[model samples]
Target: MRRLGTFLLGVMLLAGPAFAAPLAVLVEERARSDYADSLPPEGAFEITVKEPPKGEVLTLAEFWMDPRSGKFLANAVLETGDVQRIGGLALITLPVPVPTRRLLPDEIIMEDDLTVMRLPVGRVGAYVETEIEEVIGKQVRRVLTPGRPIQAQSIIHPLVISRGDRVEISFSDGLLALRSPGRALSDAHEGQEVRIVNLISNKTVTGIATGAGTVEIVQ
Candidate 1:
């Protein structure tokens, strides 16, 4: 391997001048705005030169580019007849999840409820969860259908205490404890505040949800 590498280096040194040519490849600025699912059109690039290579032909190849960022990949090809040069650019994409079926209001989301999709970096919204783990097991906040992107506002933590259920109300300050039965006026998950109507007195009060069908009085 060492002898073959030395021999190749010598050949390259001898032929260095023959391949020494000056060339410039520039992607037009509009490419940044024109990127999408399709490759950037040929008109999105411009090549400039002062003089033609000495008895050499310039060959410029089409480039594969990301549609979202209008940036090309390292596969770009540039060749100069008398002066040789090459340049490359790389772009990144984002992986996002979309609902595979209709999610109704009050329904809980599950792992099989969504599908992963690849989107151009800029097309992804900041409030959207990029992975399924962040979305699955959450309760749907409203109606969403197939192909709709999942947003942070579209879901919520599974409710430990849902609305209208009979729950045990407890009041405590660490030293003393009191317990009573109450009716929840609204839905609340663990650690969330909710309204309850004391069953005996019929008085409304707000309390923190502590467990399934349980609430702790704030005062």
Candidate 2:
């Protein structure tokens, strides 16, 4: 009788995995559904069921989780219609903006140049840009590799005035206004300061780049 009982226990242990597999899928799906609203479109949760409930669970009736700790509790209905509680932990990933191809400095980021990638929340850093909109229309300040998170300082507004370009320099003190042709000594974006050499006076001065090939001297 002792040997027979031991054989029966071994059979139940062998059958445990078959029951656990289906329950694991259900649990993972429930966790994803519970946090759908907070998740990005391309984001998902990687669930690890620490303990599969010890019962013949037919279906999950309800589920919920703590967003902070990633601890989840589910109310499952057993085959016998009995309600059982199951708990586990999960690791969630979020979408981050990345370049679709290798981008070089001075290249402007277009909609097609950017895409989203899923990364573990802990791996994303504060220096990275999270949204595609944040990168679009911005010019690359440094080389960006494909599928890598873009650093915040890796891009800037497209330069409106390039070095050595002829620009119209304007000076105004409310009462007096004068405009002159000058050459840009440095590349500058809109509203950024640039050094300009006056074509007529043969003198160098600093001014703010107001538009394409245009600089406004304030001082």
Candidate 3:
């Protein structure tokens, strides 16, 4: 086993250059609103770099705009110990609008002079830099693509649950009783679902409810 481990380590070292280089492609946008406002609001402007040349990892950095003009300057470091060459760059532009709201008199008075004057009116923008690499080890070769629009539904789960409800709990063979303290629980019903949370690992599992205050985890 030790010999096998050493062999694997040697192989990894030999392939380090090809695998260690970071070539990340990221999507960035600016919103002209306060934290209380909804994020990624409709019609918000966005800028994207669809495809960036792959290179060894060095330093990836970005700078914010002057706020007066929606422009950003980006820079990157390559594994070849040289800065990225300027050219063959692809950029994507999206136009988004900002919404207006009433600000409290106190809020207006507490603003910083620099930020207050540069406050975004209807549009904002950002620049992003990422270190990424091509996916490897898979049977099929896949091109590395970034800035793909992520569907909102992908991260959302459909469940009907409300706060402060009396609920039951059941496990593999034993039934445990617990109360809901007005928190997020997936849609479940009596004698229909079972849920378990592993506090140590912060993992949750769902199963079936067999009876009142009793749940049966379908292993």
The weakest ten consecutive residues by lDDT in model 3 span 129-138
Indicate whether candidate 1 or candidate 3 has the larger lDDT.
1
lDDT tens digits, residue span 66-112, model 1: 55444443222223212222234333346678889999977888878
lDDT of 2 by residue, 79-144 (tens): 444566778876678889898999999999999998888887766788989888889999999999
Count of backbone clashes for each model? 6, 0, 13
- Worst window of 10 by summed lDDT in candidate 1: 74-83
Which consecutive 10 residues in model 2 have the weakest lDDT in total? 1-10
Model with the higher lDDT, candidate 1 or 2: 2
TM-score of each candidate? 0.59, 0.62, 0.21
lDDT of 3 by residue, 17-58 (tens): 334333323213321322225333332333434345356434
**Ranking under lDDT, best-scoring first?**
2, 1, 3
Ranking by TM-score: 2, 1, 3
Compute the lDDT for candidate 2: 0.81
> Which has the higher TM-score value, candidate number 1 or candidate number 3?
1
Error of 1 at 4 (Å): 33
Task: Provide the global lDDT of candidate 3 against the true structure.
Answer: 0.32
Q: Give the winner by lDDT.
A: 2
